[model samples]
Target: MRIYTRKGDDGTTGLYFGGRVAKDSALPTAYGTVDEAQAFIGLARAEAEPGSELDQLLVAIERDLWVLMADLATDETNRAKLVAGETLVTDAMVASLERRIDDLSARFTMPSEFVVPGGNRVAAALDVARTVVRRAERDSLAAAAPGSRVVAYLNRLSDLLWTMARWQEGDSLTARAVAPLAGEAEKGA
Candidate 1:
């Protein structure tokens, strides 16, 4: 099959069901951001240690993003065709991210201050992926339709990526700065 259909030469793209819309429309913007996030996640996965838990999790997330893009590409009229756990984003998908975050967050001390991203190659790549996921979350919210669980999924995904970045960095490698309590330091003296 020829990759170039020449159908979008007029700056319009096809929706999943049949209709076409401007390439810059809300739906495409949202899914395009998701695609960007998925690519960065791939980069992070490549940087992860071979056979490590981080690598495994990134692979799973990449698969999930494909489902998310499909859901986003579909028009609201065609939403009934979306199969949960496959083409559709579901509550369980978001819950799974929360569970993973909780599991990983338990392994490290919560950062008391802003973390300066970039402790190592893998961690830095994960941080970049996390930021892109944040953008995707915002775009998803804007493009959301009734019966769409994509917003919830993207929301939890950003949280998961943030937690994973911290998990990969651990305590020793995480760059953090803390401020002393107002008068506590003087009182101690």
Candidate 2:
């Protein structure tokens, strides 16, 4: 009933099914980063209109992160216990993200160059989430099993986050849009 178990005080944390590992171990690090990304996604969701498509989509993604964290938290010994689309990352999940990315990308004029993040509050939050998702993706690589789809899911999730941020921004400002530095202009002259 109480939240604090005082179990992790020893610097090790419990996995989903069973077993423990250091708090800084690869699986914990990966899932912890996924938790962070989910929080930022919540911030973006809060900024969206209630009942809006963006809000709904963010809610779904947030729920998916729970499944992802569960997948990452389970050790290889208990890997067989994971349920696809529930406790484990599934191909359907990755494909769903890809489909959303394509749909959202179709709604906007894709920027030809790198984008500056702060276009608006929701978009900015989405951008921050996207970056965290990227970090999660990298971390998952070290934690994932050889045939695990966790890494693939994180990879596609990051891409979907990028596309969502762009969709929320309406018009993304590309890196090329920045004015030349005064000294650079003088040097060119």
Candidate 3:
């Protein structure tokens, strides 16, 4: 298995299930943007505190993104490989993200003005990741070419990231506004 297949030298590449398309094809763009998102998450993770929750969340998100890439990698013949990943980027994922955004918001300060994108290395890196995520969402939607659930997921994910950044910046969201913890109210009382 040589890495240099030279098949893509002519501005074309093979998909996951023996399908060939242009390098800039929609399928590639969709999955390729996912790859980009994962790379940015890696960078952000490296810059984040070693054991911070944000760091951990990014790790999980990156893992999910790999699954997403697999899902997006359909062959040229529309004969997809067994993707193994969650074929649907479900509403639950979106809800989970909203919960996370709320959790971070509860402990941070909300911002009204635009952010400068640099409170620390992690923050800066996260900002970069957020932008890339937005771009990925755009590209993914373009590739979807219709009302796609995955595209909607990406859009929400980007907003989640933006809110997460602000949350990291000390914008505190209320506990009630977020998902209620199992014993949080009891503890507070």
The residue-by-residue lDDT of candidate 2 on 1-189, one tens digit each, is 999999999999999999999999999999999999999999999999999999999999999999999999999999999999999999999999999999988887888766767778998898899899999999999998778888898888888888888887785444237557799999999
Candidate 3's clash total is: 9
Cα error of candidate 3 at position 137, Å? 1.2
Greater TM-score among 2 and 3 belongs to: 2
TM-score winner, 1 or 2? 2
Off by over 4 Å in 2: 171-177, 185-189
Higher-scoring candidate on lDDT, 2 or 3 = 2
Stretches of candidate 3 exceeding 4 Å from the true structure: 75-87, 145-147, 171-189
lDDT of 1 by residue, 1-189 (tens): 999999999999998867898999999999999999999999999998888999899999999998899899988888888889798988999899999999998998878777777867788898899899999989888687776889888888888888888888886554455446769878887
lDDT of 3 by residue, 1-189 (tens): 787978889998776656678989887988898898889889978877788888889887887776666556655245233433364355676677778777766666676455666655666677787888888877776565343356766776777677766656553322224434669977887
TM per prediction? 0.90, 0.93, 0.77
The Cα local distance difference test for each model comes to 0.87, 0.90, 0.69
How well does model 1 score by local distance difference test?
0.87
Q: If the candidates were sorted by their TM-score against the true structure, best first, what order would they fall in?
A: 2, 1, 3
* Deviation from native of the Cα of residue 5 in model 2, angstroms: 0.8
lDDT of 2 at 86: 96
